[model samples]
Target: MIITVAHQKGGTGKSTIATNLAVELKTSLLDLDKQHSSIIFNYKRAHAGLEPLDCYSIAESQCRFDGQRPVPEAKLDEFLDLFKGDPKTDLVIDVGGFDSPLNRKALFFGDYLLTPCAPSGTEIYGLQMFEEILQEAEDIAGIHLLTHVLINNADKRSQKRIAEMQAYVKGKPEHFELCQSVIGQRISFKTAYETGQSVVELHEGARTAKLARAYLHSADEMTALCAEIRHALGKGV
Candidate 1:
């Protein structure tokens, strides 16, 4: 199963979602993002003596863009095939923030395409633009696709804002599906990643009482999200 975390807009916590989800699922990750965030995270994990994730990277130079947009490269199929060809392997891909031939191809090849959006006006606009791009990809591929929208970094105190965002996503049932699991804005997410460990792992070794409590909360949320994702994929709840 090829699960891709992608968004054409930046700062939507794409890498955060990808790294945490990959760790929780214990799956191989393909870092197509230009920043190579997942590759760096794996490096930290390896040095920290944690079981390093199986990670790979493809340089942006590999994709040739025509004018401003990327032109399809035949080698892309060969590259993606390395990850998607195996039916039994679960591959998690983190794509960059841009509309390009490479990203569009990833969307077409993905078994489940997930887009993380923060609860804000700007992110909503970006999501709308991504919807257009997804539509274009569908037109080219001759098949319809739905991008699961996960609300990330949600403020726990602002229930109204989260509700409004959910309604907006629910209004477009055909194009997007609102993920049942929501990831909140928590400090543990940042602190845990700095150590190259997921919240699930961090809670086990938390140094202080407050740290342990915070990590435990984040871990529970992450675990629930992973379970929801697995259930959606028909693996189990």
Candidate 2:
């Protein structure tokens, strides 16, 4: 399956969600973001003496936006074709936060599209604009599209705001649906990303008792999030 994580606005924790999901689910990662965030994370993982993930970087000099399709349609098709109907493997794609040919193409091709949105004014408004982008992609692909919206990086302050987000998402049920799993804001997420580790793995390497407890909580949250996503995809319970 081609699981794409995309949004039109940046800093919604896309890389965090993508890398952790790929690691936790044991899937390959395809980084289409111009910043090459996942690629760098994998590099750090390798240097840290951990088993490196099957992450591919298709950005920077290797990618060009001059054409209608970035990296060629056949090239992407060949890669996606390998994963289609293959229950054993999944390709998690992290696309950049912008309206471009590459992002639109990913939307069109993804078997399951995910958009991570933080519960904030800007992000909520941005989702409205992104809905327009999704429509445009569907127009090109000649099919209706729906994306799973994940409320990521949430905290106590945002907990009350989830109802607002839910109402908006429910109002547009045909466009997107909110995931039942909500990922909270935690320091472990940042520290693990910097060191190229998933929260699930980071908890094992914690140094202090307090830190260990925090990391363990983060790991539990991540596990729940991954479980919910997998269940949605009918992978497993």
Candidate 3:
């Protein structure tokens, strides 16, 4: 399955979700974001003498854009020609938080799309705009884009905000499905990122018992989300 992790606004935990999925699933990661955050994280992991992730860089140079907009048909074909040629490989693409022709083209090739958004008014507005873009891509591609909107970095104490976000997503079932699994704003995630280790990779001695438990919980949440995503794509858990 080809999965694309994308959002138009930054700081929505796009890299966080992408890296976690890649590490947990042991899939190849295609870093299309200009920031190259995934690549850097993998490097950190490798430097730490840890097992490295299978990764590739699909730099912006490989894409052809007409002005600022990508010609969807050409871009879609380009991606399909390159990535779809390998039928057995599960690929994950991490796109930067900027709306571009390349990003739109990537969306068309995704068998499953995961968009992470924080619980905020601006982030919700960004999600709405992203849905419209996806709709436009669907029109251009003549196919329904399978998409899931993930609520990430949610505050554990803000039940009201989480409830509101859930309600908003429930009202827009046609645009994107809301993921039942959520990632909370926890310090363990930051610690794992800095060390180039996923929550699943953290040893007991590496963190306090409370933090280790938090990481374990986050890892379980991520695993459940991955299973849900695969099942949605008609793949076995």
**Each candidate's TM vs. the true structure?**
0.90, 0.91, 0.86
Q: What pairs collide in candidate 3?
A: 70-101
* Model 1: per-residue Cα lDDT over 1-237, one tens digit each: 788899999888888889998998988887777777777777778878888887766544453321122223556677567667455678788898888887788898888889998888888888889989988888999989898999999997988888888888999887899998889999888887888898899998888988788788789988998898888877897
Candidate 2: regions farther than 4 A off: 63-74
Candidates in descending TM-score order: 2, 1, 3
Clashing pairs in 1: none
Error of 1 at 129 (Å): 0.4
RMSD of each: 4.8, 3.9, 5.1
Task: Candidate 2: give the clashing pairs.
Answer: none
TM-score pick, better of 1 and 2? 2
lDDT by residue (tens digit), candidate 2, 171-224? 888789888877888888989988989999999888888888979878988899
List, residue by residue over 55-82, the lDDT tens digit for candidate 3.
7665444443211222233354664556
Q: How close to the true structure is residue 117 of candidate 3, measured as C-alpha lDDT?
A: 87
Whole-model alpha-carbon lDDT for candidate 1? 0.82
In each prediction, how many residue pairs overlap at the backbone (N, C-alpha, C within less than 3 A)?
Answer: 0, 0, 1
Which number leads on TM-score? Answer: 2
